[model samples]
Target: MRTEFNWHLTAWKSLGRPSPGDIIWETELLNHSELVMRKRAYQNSTLYATFPRDPCDSYVHCGGNGNSVLNSSLICQCLKRFVPGSLENWNLKDFLKGCVRRKPFSCRNDGFAKYLQLKLLDTTHNWINKSKNLVECMAKCLSNCSCSAYTDIDVRGRGSSSAIWFE
Candidate 1:
């Protein structure tokens, strides 16, 4: 008489937040029987075998709080993909150079056009428009070499002020 031995595979399961820098490589198997096999690896060369985990039981968290600087950094990365020479450390001088290169007569009355409205810190304002004469304003700055950057004045909300600056 011959006896047959049955070998049962161990079912893998996971619950909880994924470790930092853990990347899922592949999902080899999944079934309605609540059995699954997932291959994952961490940044530090550690391997993990994960299985079906309860979605409600696991907490997916994103790193880093949303801040202006962080947001700017992300935007810079996006810009780099399109504009190869664009730098994240753009200062007033760099910005002015770029503007001049793109539109040399931007400072002239016919050069600068209405860009758009920008709302910041709960204040709403049109960045450029005809009433304030954006073209003339920019033209004046261009005439004076000392001006590096120019921003429109706030017209809406609590503190409305029209102003220009040079550096």
Candidate 2:
């Protein structure tokens, strides 16, 4: 026997996703009563998930260790050499807690790894250099004993931009 469980859109929205999320509405939805949608109607069945779009677009949606790469098979994977911070939660598909490094950073022994097209992490605690090229960025980041990561950017939102992070 198949058990039916119903989840209301309002209940999901109450969790802080203020918008309707990334859903594609059927053409017929145009004819549906606006009150049904405005009233938190999941019963319309005229909407469906648009997987090309995503719901985890906020900063650090997958916590600190998991990166939210749009269109990837796994939006929340454990970082290299790391493990989920809570395997139980991961198994339960609750990826919010993200992952954790298996080994802590050892300043003198650590090295940087680079990937293409990855966005910068949280910036409230980082320093930005709008004119530094990639080579110069690395030299400066490596020269700093506390630097953990560096990336190309123009935090000023103009001109050249690069950044280094503190572990």
* Candidate that scores best on lDDT: 2
- Residue pairs clashing, model 2: 130-160, 153-161, 154-161
Model 1 score (lDDT): 0.32
Q: By TM-score, who's the top model here?
A: 2
Off by over 4 Å in 1: 1-73, 77-133, 157-161
Model 2 over residues 68-157: C-alpha lDDT tens digits?
765876667666766888889877767877787788877677777666555567664578887787788888988888887888776455
* Residue-wise C-alpha lDDT for candidate 1, range 1-167, written one tens digit per residue: 11243322432343564333334344332221223333334334333544445331111111111111224433212111122122433332122112113323333343322324322211122233334444566656567654544545545542233334443
Q: How many pairs of residues collide in each model?
A: 2, 3
State every prediction's TM-score relative to the real structure: 0.24, 0.58
Give the per-residue Cα lDDT of candidate 1 at 120.
22
Worst 10 residues of 2 by lDDT: 26-35
Report the C-alpha displacement of residue 103, candidate 1, in angstroms.
13
lDDT against the true structure, per candidate, is 0.32, 0.62
Residue 40 shift from truth in candidate 1, angstroms: 48
